[model samples]
Target: MLPWLLCALLGVLVLALLGKVCALTRSMEEICDQLADRLAGDTNNLLTLSTRDPHARRLAARLNVQLRLLRQQRRRYLNGDRELKEAVTNLSHDLRTPLTALCGYLDLLDRQETSPAVARYLDQIRSRAEAMKALTEEIFRYSLLAARESWDWEDVTLNQVLEESLLAHYGALTQRGITPQLDLTEVPVHRRLDRKAVSRVLANLLSNALKYSAGDLRVALTPAGEITFSNTAPGLTPVMVGRLFDRFYTVETGRTATGLGLAIAKLLTEAMGGTIQADYRGETLTLTLRFPPAEEKAAPRAVPGGGGVE
Candidate 1:
């Protein structure tokens, strides 16, 4: 009888140990799920395990320490980002007033009649002043746009916007002696986009082409919402092409390159749930932009009538 009782007590002890381990395993799984949820969402709560198992408790303690540190670092980064944005906004505002006054004076000077030498000097002054004014405006606009988290959206027909932008730069293109080859789809390619933002993006691309094109400029729009702007850019290196959309990055070959054009285009494109990319190959640089069709809109079924202008 004694031997039987001892054997029964040993079995009971083993079962208790197994139960404890299973409890620990379940507790650990719960802790992992809670941690994953905290990471995915905005929660930063510390992990707490109900099990008194040493291993489970230790893991929970370690995770809680790391979580607290991560939250602190994230908070610090957000604060710094906000501060920098505010500074840029203030600086843009400060520069605009003086820039306006300077442009006013330059206009006044341009109106005054003078000798040929004086006239030449005034013209140079006017050109430089105009460039400065343009740069100032772009900077101010960039700061404002960067600070904005959302955009005012609308239904924008890209073909019409493209035509308008091209026409606006027609004089510049003509002066440069470059006839743009345009292949536009006849069927209206409609997108739910910010008209002003898309217009600015097109204008920037056209302006960049005017500055860099070595005789050839090609622009095409497809029914799939893809827009391509291709031009011969002999001056750009592979490295430069890679950083084409980086903010305030200018290269020696680009005259009057503020480096903000592509950056602004990228910012606005991303904000509108679109993408813009640059490709460089054998003296040619191509910029491609696309906007994903809106979810609620049906796929466009209109037949495409494509045309090209030399």
Candidate 2:
């Protein structure tokens, strides 16, 4: 009887040891599975241990907090990288125009002659220089707008703005022998906008149209106070249309275009709660400009006699 009792006690001790070993094995397997899952995860690879496991749960919570912070940092880094790339692209495009012009002017000046050809070359140089100046100014203006700053708005007349822009480009239009087709109806078209900014937008659009148009420049104002500028051109592709408002995107013309004109215009327009769009079909390019209607007190002035030149 004494021997049987000792054997029974030994058996009980062995069973208790086996239960502890089984529990340890199960815990180890769980930990290994969690580690594998975390390793396989693409992002935020913090393991989530069961709440019953106090030590593992605490570790997982700490890891999760760190992972979230890492994700936020990574997003910021990527965003900054993308913006830097865009800025570089814009800078390259802007620089290319002036560089091309400078080269052409230098080549012409190198020639030994005092003839009409030399005069033409000088004229080309002057034109290119002016274009470069305009491009620089436009870039500066866009930078100001992109700084996320606000401007004071006042009531401005749409017709007056259009007229001023037209007057500014009158000389160039006359030189090109393109008639100004003004289709303005008798209406009071006013909107709350920054006058100087809106003027720049219109000027940029008209300048681009005059530069590219082969013939027939039409400037039409609708009764609803919307403005439309259309010109005869070789038309634009779908790709060009899509990128019309993108910075440093120009048409496929071999001519020296800084490609920032339309981009600046678009930015200023949006800043003023207005919209601008392009419609191209065959050999025609039309730009539609829309804004809030003007106050009744701000009516358009009568068209001047002889269409006063700039």
Candidate 3:
């Protein structure tokens, strides 16, 4: 009788240990779910487990501490980003007045007659001044976009927009002695987009091609809303192509580039729920842009990592 009683006691102890283990496992599973949701920007709930086991309690506590640290770091990053945007805005605004004055002086000088040597010097000064002015304007526009300016969205015909943009740059293309190969869809592809923003994107791409094209530029737009711009770039490497959209990043081949054109295009494209990517192979560089159709434009746009043209 005594042996049987001791066996029963041991059996009860083992059952209790198994029960505790099961409870801890359930608690851990819930904690993991919550952590995953939080990391995906879907939830803000803190980890709370209802397990009485001391080991499980300690694990929960450690995870909560780490979550708190993560939240603190994210808060700091947001604050710093806001401050930087404000600084850029103010600096860009301040530089504009003097830039305008410089351009005005150059224009005045251009209107007056001078010797060929003096004319050459004045032309060089004018070119640099114009470049500076353009860069300043881009910086200002970038600041506004960073500050989240409101968009005037409408139903835009992308085909017409692209055609107009190409026509506008026809003179530039002719000057570069490169004939653009265009394969545009006959059917008009439409998207709920900002007309100005889309035009800017196309203009930036064409301007980049004009700057870096070896001798040819190929552009194609499909009925599915995929736009492709490809050109032969002589000295661009794969690494350079990867960082082409990064702000203020310029390559040795782009001597006069401000490096913000493609960056702005990326910002506007993403804001309008679109995707853009760049690829480089065997001295050829290509950029692809896609916009969701009007029916699907309401979905959230995922920000892509860096990619673009020179």
Best by lDDT: 3
Candidate 1 residue 231 C-alpha distance from true site, Å? 0.7
lDDT of 2 by residue, 101-173 (tens): 7767666775756688877867787677767765665565455455434454788878888988999899999
lDDT, candidate 1, 33-111, per-residue tens: 9899877655767787778888888888888898888888878877887787678768878887887888788778778
- Each candidate: what lDDT? 0.81, 0.71, 0.84
Error of 2 at 53 (Å): 27
Instruction: Enumerate residue pairs that collide in model 1.
Output: none
TM-scores of the models, in the order given: 0.75, 0.56, 0.80
For model 3, how does the per-residue alpha-carbon lDDT over 169-222 read when each residue is reduced to its tens digit?
999999999999999999999888778878989999999898889989999999
What ordering of candidates by lDDT runs from best to worst? 3, 1, 2
Cα-lDDT of candidate 2? 0.71
| Best candidate, TM-score | 3
